[model samples]
Target chain A: MALDADATLGEAGEFGLISQLVAQLGEALTDDEHVLVGPGDDAAVLRVKHGHVVVSTDLMVEGRHFRRDWASAEDVGHRAAAQNLSDINAMGGTARHLTIGLAAPADLPVQWALDFARGFAQECASVGATVVGGDTTRADEIVIAVTVLGECTVSPVLRSGARPGDVLALTGRQGWAAGGLAVLGRGFRSPRVLVEAYRRPEPPYAAGKEAAEAGATSLIDVSDGLLAEAAHLAEASGVAIDVRRDAFDVPEPLVAVGAALGADPMQFILGGGDDHALLATFPDTASVPAGWQVVGEVRDGEGVTVDGSEYDGPTGWTHF
Target chain B: MALDADATLGEAGEFGLISQLVAQLGEALTDDEHVLVGPGDDAAVLRVKHGHVVVSTDLMVEGRHFRRDWASAEDVGHRAAAQNLSDINAMGGTARHLTIGLAAPADLPVQWALDFARGFAQECASVGATVVGGDTTRADEIVIAVTVLGECTVSPVLRSGARPGDVLALTGRQGWAAGGLAVLGRGFRSPRVLVEAYRRPEPPYAAGKEAAEAGATSLIDVSDGLLAEAAHLAEASGVAIDVRRDAFDVPEPLVAVGAALGADPMQFILGGGDDHALLATFPDTASVPAGWQVVGEVRDGEGVTVDGSEYDGPTGWTHF
Candidate 1:
């Protein structure tokens, strides 16, 4: 039976709303043979193909992470799932299952939650993952927290494995989301490419495993901007990284947006985040995998430098 | 290294506050042999001893699930951990790792987040679990979401396994938290037992495995009151559960609180929740393990009843 369009969470109730949302998962919920038990239970049971499991979690709070006016419930869900799944992918793991915890006000629409679940399921499906279980409760504002479970066939990559003389590589778009945000902030939505990129990030899920298989020295998810993530890898590995400004051919969309907004496109590539790009270090440039662009080089030091010196710009996002 | 007690999250910054909270995990982070990687990575890698894993997630919002005035930061953390751990336990699994997602306002005290981590670590330690990885961000209120990963040596007991003739049993105190909430709501804190129970539930973590070992046909965590959970078992198993009211002996604390408040102690036992007691169904009375009280029996019908009659009071909790 179709739920009334005007139905709110208070009217549908928790159990009612949950069932509706679970329906949104559809095939992804049961198609996974690894999932021994799905929802409507105390806990979900999954048969891990590999003995080793990679786990990560992320919280997306309304107003802080995304505003309801600017993004759809599906966009919110996709963003929430992408962040945690990217964490697992960064470890060279294939995501298997997701458990979500959602808190929303009573007046929230039930259809909105269902759409959120649909988006979450679709995002997981893109990487052959499933939504296993979750908990929902009432709160003053919407808070969506997702935890993803994954399996790594090979030794999981860590940020501390990088060493001096390593070649730095990146896969997936950089600064596209940042450019999209700037466009949205300026009250112009004509740049559909930027706005859509901001709405849903397309993280290169397969590149993580490919990098690991290609003998990556270290790997990290570039969610906190290229400069900040490079700094993180540097700090963890005790090696500095030097990004070659000439290496990057600024994408046409970003260039157009930057020109329109009177901003430097390089700043977006250097300081923008939310692209969920995979940043990895290889022992040599030849070891870097296909589909990855060489962006920088690792050196014996402790900080990130652009063109051998600091490029003055906001390095990354800080939640607080 | 001690942090300033008066420092807020905004003052300490995200990375600074995270390191402080991570320090609270202490030995749990490094001592786990199954954990290949802990925090400060893209994701935590765990070597699951068993091929199967049990996973669950829960969200606790400030003022909704708890109040800072009533619950210390530690208490909130403990409660959040307990809820997820109990889910794992309910599946007859041993918890191995936890990933937390926390969202708090910028002005929230750094000490509060640190204490929360301390409580989470302590609770995980009680079950030999470790805090693995998580994401922290800013929000208008405090939202703590926890996901626990566990392993079950034996097959997980499901709620749908109960037969009509199965014996219903319970382990752990029921309604204690409810009675405690009643006491606290009336502005009386003298009854330390009730108040403490309300602050943090003491679930019989071992009882679930014991029940599974003793040939439990079905199992559930009595988090939404005994009657409600019993009904859930019945509905899932397609049988009726008749709970014997006489099986319960009203404790002295509940009796005194009920008398003072002009309420019936039986109501708390029948309609209260949050104690996270384990409820299970055994094939026979002989199969019921020690430390478990035979509370009722399954019958050929649907729904739950007390003394073969419908309950007049509240059946259970509703979030919306």
Candidate 2:
């Protein structure tokens, strides 16, 4: 059944809704070269061109990850796919396929589920991924668990690989999602740019592969703010990082939105999470790819420093 | 820190709980040959020995799929993993790697979470599978989403490949889980075998590949009841399946449990679900693999028949 605007999921029924959504998603998300078996099977069959496969799973909760009042169903789907895809890409791999395990209240609108599949399918397709089989169940709140499978283009980079004297670099805008959240929290719906960033992230996927090919020592997606991620990299690699605040001197969309929210954009860049930007450390800064901008340098000690002093601002994100 | 008997997850904190549980599971679940990266990365990397991979995802919810009062934390984990692993096996593949997405109430005991991981880990190991990575989040009820990746031993079997005259066969017992559920529902905790059947299913994982090697025409795991699956096979293969109840005439645990409950065991066998038993069709009954019992025969028609007559029991299982 075609879901009306307000039709609840229970009214649509489980199998019928799955058939409708799967048929729609399968058409758009399938890559014949990568996918052997699609939905309506005991399991999905896929061809892994590379000998090794990269995989990641990320879960999003309705209230914890995204408030329904602040984000649309499409936004939730896209964000879920983006976060998982970004992690796979951060390992210097190309996105290949993905599956979703979704749970929502029976009273949820069926239209919301369809809209979710639409955005999720499109996002995976953008990364040349096929939608494999997944599970759906009933829940008190909407819980989306997405796992992405990716193919390696080069030797995978890990956080523990960074060495001393390596340059820390980033390839996408930071703090935009947090700024969008600020605007949304303030009840201003018109600052569509910030709100959009907060909803559907556009991570620099290709840059990760480029950095890996250029021999990046370590890499991570900036999902939990710059300083916080920097701290994780430092701890994992056993090296300190010196941040050059001047290197992030460019004035962009985040700076423009600062005045409207009455908040400092710089502070958001250093403290806010969910940007999903590609952050990496290169032994030679000159070898860093075109899109990546230098932000800091790996040092001998532990922890991170900003412009020759301690960065005591909000470090990273932690869920309770 | 070791969790006390009643220590809640929230008391352990998110990062701390993850660190402890992941440390525990990683020790038991990782194999160097199949897994390159384990729990501590953005995504885990695995070496797929087979050129192609078989993938399936299954999710279980608290109230709908299992109740904490009826099943222990370990049993829940094993059942969830068994469901996903069985799907991969049903495709004529060897289980290789798996990922989990877990959401639990903050007030849940940390010990319960650890036990769940332990059971989940052991079940995956039983099939020579390694745990890659997973996502853990907070929720009102415990939700487990398992995605299994398998390697094809022979050409994968499809549900639509059966032809007329193919003999339908099954490996492993049916209706045991339902029988177990019935026991649990009736508040009778004894009869450990019946309760165990409902909680931890032992699917004939090896038999799936064996059937394919012996030239089976079609295959599926009976997760949604035998009669329903028979109809599915018939519809998918464009043939009718005539089920022979007498073929399954031999006494087994299911029949033994029926007497205790004072219910028709045949109803559970035909209509009850969650057995994870391997059901397949071979071109010749004589060619059926060892341990497989012939249950029916395929013919030129649609739908399923019991002793050459239409079955009038419950058609199948559907999630709300």
DockQ of 2: 0.77
Per-residue lDDT tens digits of candidate 1, residues A1-320? 56664799988888888877777875776678998999988999999887999988888888878888777989878888898889988999899899988899999998889888888888999899999999899988999999999999988999998999999999999999989888888888847887889889999999889988999989999888999999999999999999998888899999999899999998888998898999999999889878899999999978999989987888888988
Off by over 4 Å in 2: A1-6, A29-31, A250-253, A256-262, A308-310, B1-6, B28-30, B250-262
lDDT of 1 by residue, B1-320 (tens): 56775899999888888888788885777778988898899988989887999998888888878889887899988888998899988988888899988899999999899889889888889999999888899988889899999999989999999998899999898988999888878888847898899889999999988888888999999888889899889988999999999998899998988999999999888888888999999999999999999999999989998899988988788888
Judged by lDDT against the true structure, how good is candidate 2? Answer: 0.84
Can you give the DockQ of every candidate in the order shown?
Answer: 0.88, 0.77
lDDT of 2 at B258: 79
What is the overall TM-score of model 1 with all chains considered together? 0.98
Q: After superposition, how far is residue B99 of candidate 2 from its true place, in Å?
A: 0.7
Each prediction's Cα lDDT score? Answer: 0.89, 0.84
Pull out the clashing pairs in model 1: none
